[model samples]
Target: MNDGLAAVLAALVGLVGAVGGAAIGGMAATRGARVGAETAARATARQVQDQAAVDHMHWLRGQRLQAYQDLLAAYDAYSDAVKAVEQWASREAGDAGRRPGEYVQRVEAFLRAHMVIRLVGPVEARTMSAVLWEALQTHAFKLQDWALLVERRSGDETIAGAREELAPARAAMVDAHDVFLSEATRVVGTPMGN
Candidate 1:
């Protein structure tokens, strides 16, 4: 073979080998980059999931706490109504003849049925709190009926008589307080009695 031809052939063989080696190195680099990307994606997904779980738990806890607070406030109002009833009963039993107000019965029923009355607020009425609240309101209304009965009595109705009518309202209010315990339970994703 001619020297020039042999030299050209050798050069071509070296070029082919160099190109082959470069291609293998490129494939290795691509494989390493793919593994790194997959690992990073998995880590990011895990962090997002953990954060979401934490946020959801916090929201649930808040709802439960608020429910208890609302129920407690309702109970406090009911207790106040009961105290009024005790005072009324005492006054009626005493010899002093202080006449009660005509609307006294209204006040008494409001106190007795306080739970149902207090629940009448738009937001609370819409909630699970509404059931007991409606019952209390109804109880208070019934006390008004009692007052009407007294009004139609053959004997002269004194202010004290009207005031005494309020006694039923006051009792209903106390019952409303009792029922609030159940409403609060509903807020926590549990049954009221539970």
Candidate 2:
């Protein structure tokens, strides 16, 4: 071959090698950028999911707190209603009208609150709530029966016997209330911590 022809062929070979190297580098850069983009996208999605889970936990904690507060408040109302009924029963028959409706309303409120506790519970709290609710109901019914006997102008001995029967029920209710409170406190962690 001529020396000039040999030089031309070598130049062509070198140019082809340079073009191929450029193409390979360009493809590698594009692949790296795509992988980087995919990685960033996955990280962002994971962060969003973690944030959502935290938000849900906060919301659930708030709900449980609210339910506990409501149930406690309802108990207060029911107790007040019972007191009112007892007061009416102790007075002269005509001094104050019967408060059966008020007592029933308070009991209904308590029941509704209890239902919320059952719904938002962590099992342990729910069990305690059930015990407390049963005690409350038993005491309320006994008190109602005694009040009715008083309204009927029952003998002193009969009324005293009925009143005496309330002691055990009242004690049970008090004990149940304490247990329920402790369980509720345990289950309902601090707002910031939960």
Candidate 3:
């Protein structure tokens, strides 16, 4: 009777030990899996955030490029209008009439473009654009005044003298245009936040 009782007791102890070991092993595996899943989730979130930042930077670069192209085109149109007006001024009585409205429209287009640059800029380019616009406006006004004087025969300054007087303003506008191009190009070429 004592031997049978001892065998039964030993069997019960072995069963409990096996069950306890399995439970501990299962708990450890669950904890390890949870930790791994959390790490993966964090890594995925970080990757998404980094990708969004890159996309935003690319979009901003494109916007700036478009703004610059528009501004340059508008400026060219304004310059052409100024030339047209000057040519009209030079012609004698029997020719086509002047289109002052066209000049005003071109100026408005250029100003709109300049305003866009002011909205999206690297400050230096914006400042140069402003200086360029001011110089151009001054030159255009001087040309208009000269044309008026010529039409009315009120001023003694000849066309040659008018050209000489405009030379400095033209030079300043050219310089400003060059500097704006340089600064804008540098800004576009550099990486974000640099």
Q: What is candidate 3's lDDT per residue for 64-135, written digit by digit as tens?
A: 888888878887897788778777766763463643547678877878888888887767778878987887
Candidate 2 structure quality by residue, lDDT tens digits, 1-194: 99999999999999999999999999999999999999999999999999999998877778788888988998888888888877787787667575465877887888999998788777887899899999999998898888878888788889889999889998998899899898788777655423
Cα RMSD for predicted model 3? 2.9
Better of 2 and 3 by TM-score: 2
Task: Name the regions of candidate 1 deviating beyond 4 angstroms.
Answer: 1-15, 31-35, 89-128, 143-194
Off by over 4 Å in 2: 94-96, 190-194
lDDT of 1 by residue, 1-194 (tens): 99999999999998888899899988999998999999999999999999988776665556455545655554455445534443543443334243234334444443444444343322442343455555555544554454444444424456456556566666665565565555554545543212
What overall lDDT, based on C-alpha atoms, would model 3 receive against the true structure?
0.78
Estimate candidate 2's alpha-carbon lDDT, on a 0 to 1 scale.
0.85
Candidate 3 or 1, higher lDDT = 3
TM-score for each predicted model, relative to the true structure: 0.50, 0.88, 0.81
Best by TM-score: 2
